[model samples]
Target: MTDHYDAIVVGTGFAGAFFLLRYLQHAPPKARVLVLERGRNDCKVWQLRNRRTSSLNTEEFFINNNPEKEWLMSLGFGGSSNTWWGGVARMMPGDFQLQSRYGVGTDWPLRYEDLETYYGDAEVIMAVSGPADSPMPRSRPFPLRPHRFSDTDALLKKTFPDGWFHPATTRASAPTGTRGICCGAGICELCPHDANFSISNGLRRLHDDPRVTLRLQATVEQVETSGDLARGVSYTSDGQLRRATADLVVLAASALFNPHILLRSGITHELLGKRLHEQMPVDVCLNLRGVKGYNGSTIISGNGYLFYEGEHRRQHAACLIETWNSPFNYRRAALRAERGRWTERAFFRFMFDDLPRADNKVTVNAANPHLPEVTFNGYSDYAQRGVDRIPAMVDTLAKALPIEEIESIEVARSTSHIQGTVVMGNDPATSVVDRYLMHHRIRNLLVLGSSAYPTASPAYPTLTLSALSLWAADHLFTRSA
Candidate 1:
């Protein structure tokens, strides 16, 4: 028997989970929702356990936590949020108006003000804590109190100017009171404390809802499109091919997989895989003399903004101070620096927002039938400008936090925060989805998450993505009514 649903949400990441939660909250009594995830049903905490030296040597350690090779994507129901550093912040108001201000990227179909309510709602759902009011105008105050900073973070804040340094409230999906005591274990790999919020938690909440059904280990191969409308999804689960149909198909997969799924389904959009962008993050580490565990938590606790003047006046930039060095990871990074190679230690990371370039794209692998490959041809001139500012920023940070010995530092390929594969815009011809996140061609198909963001703003995309998902769900619910 073919299963059916009011809505079928793909991928159990932040976007997927947020959509499901909002749908359940607002959808009609008869609405039935199905969520498909490629990873296991439950959070895989055991996989992050037993992090010994051998695990590090064997590359068995968690990515972000250990020196293991782990992409930002996860193999569990919660998606990357399960293992993310839990540093959540909303995109600045200027971020939405990047095109008008800088004339570089396309403007979002919706403004930051349009999403203000939803952003506030998302903060409550995610339990974000920070200053009530954000630096950005038109933003509502945070629903909950902000998380307190560690001693190291406090010292850093004292060293930097108030405008130059702001204590950003780190938001997480973890239950309140689970942080601090969680020890921030395996943060880069997985949330060792289970304090980090993952969609798995939300999925679990809907287990008894009766209206919602979650299918794990079900990898969706394609969105079966009949003409311009997506009819169903073809997935492989437990070596069997299964198909499920939904009244509305929502693609909440990460920025990486969303475009691939659309392209595989033969859904043609002019900008389907074009204009990809990721904030270039430069990690800088300095070894403090006589300070043990100087780097406290993996979560970003502070940030600094730099606004350049001139033709680039509209371009906004900021650097976050997150992630303290783990002894093991630090040692490895130091060794790489000793060998004259770029490593994570001996430097702090400066995340720079870059203008989108059309050359960056996502396409299916020719040799591999099921694999998708992403190729970022090069950075834009605006990105080059950001790169140019790195030296000066690094100098400022180095001078502020002077260390007895500078170990090693380098920039590496990051999958932690990538966005804009399927962006939303006013013109259907230029964007994959409309302002409401509905596919331009497919009436019953909607795309949620950072994938629909036109530009990756200076702040973290999770909170904004969550808010957008909620907004999309609200629209779909009202429409269904």
Candidate 2:
């Protein structure tokens, strides 16, 4: 017996969710759609368990790079959307034209205008909370008004005074479906309510959809291709080998996994696994004089993007700074014991824009082709210049605000914003995919996620990736017909 569908989607994270939503909206009612996810659907179990214990990174996936460094991702039905602190920022318009505007990196094939409408669509679906006025130009306002600044955030605003705005977040201030109003528990990594947007909120509807069929805990091993067309995909479930045929295949797996699957299928283009990179997250710890930070939101409350894009890009990579609203509770007691003083502490995170390099990439080991071999070229001098800008920013804030001593600055070992392994562009020779995210060589196969990003834009990649997925789905289904 053979199983077949009009289309098949792999992974169920940010990219996959939006792709499926848009595809279903456009596909004929009777068109069959199959979704394969390697992780189990157990959001309730995980949510309950997380409340009892501090959730750790999943060990099911591994990389050949530094063992101490963890990739900020989750292996579950909803993917990282279930685990990540939900801060979604739209890319600055200049981000789309980096190469042309600043001669710093590869230019995205599509401009911000091309995806502006889809960005608005994603914001509504995710229930984003953001200020009416933002530094970045927009076609429309966010769906919900921005949350009020927590006491801690208000103090920071008074301190810095410039380039600040309420961040766009997925945590709801009102009920949307089964999601409840956020109580500001400050442990948002494991949001107790469905307040933070996660595909788990709509998992039931997707599973119940007549056009959709879901296969959980099914690990895809190969993309079956014949001649120039993608035939389907091969996978293993419960230790049994199975194959599903489809006219089109969409890969929304992580940047590392996407290339591994393509390599297994023997579509080994040189650009397939090259130019992998992630933003460097620099953590700054401040012992404040007059504020408490632990009582409000646990993740971000506001962001500063003054250096996100400017003429300075000719000398340095752009940078975005975000203020953490949660207090330093994890280390507060320990630090108090060591220093013998009670004090309020705050954390500020700086994310430097990353540039792509040919030397940085993902590859498959000959001995074990199933596993991924990740090589990071590390940060460039341009990025280091961005890191160097932080102290001046701190100095400016300190001079204008209350007395605060900078206790420490810690550079994070890892980040969730992985990108550029399978980049998109107009030239087939220099890129893996086209503007629609379709493989230059294999037209029936499309890849989504930050993997399609030509450069690591100086903003959170979730919203842009979601928009790109919808754009690709709309073009693929509507135009193909």
Taken over the whole model, the C-alpha lDDT of each candidate is 0.65, 0.79
TM-score of each: 0.83, 0.93
Regions of candidate 2 where Cα sits further than 4 Å from its true position: 50-57, 155-162, 294-298, 328-343
- lDDT, candidate 1, equals 0.65
Over the stretch 106-208, how does candidate 1's per-residue lDDT look in tens digits? 6788888999888778776766656543456544665445444444445555665443433344444234654433353334455455555455543457645
Clashes of each: 13, 0
Top lDDT: which candidate number? 2
- Quote the RMSD, in angstroms, for model 2: 2.6
Question: For model 1, where is the 10-residue window of minimal lDDT?
Answer: 53-62
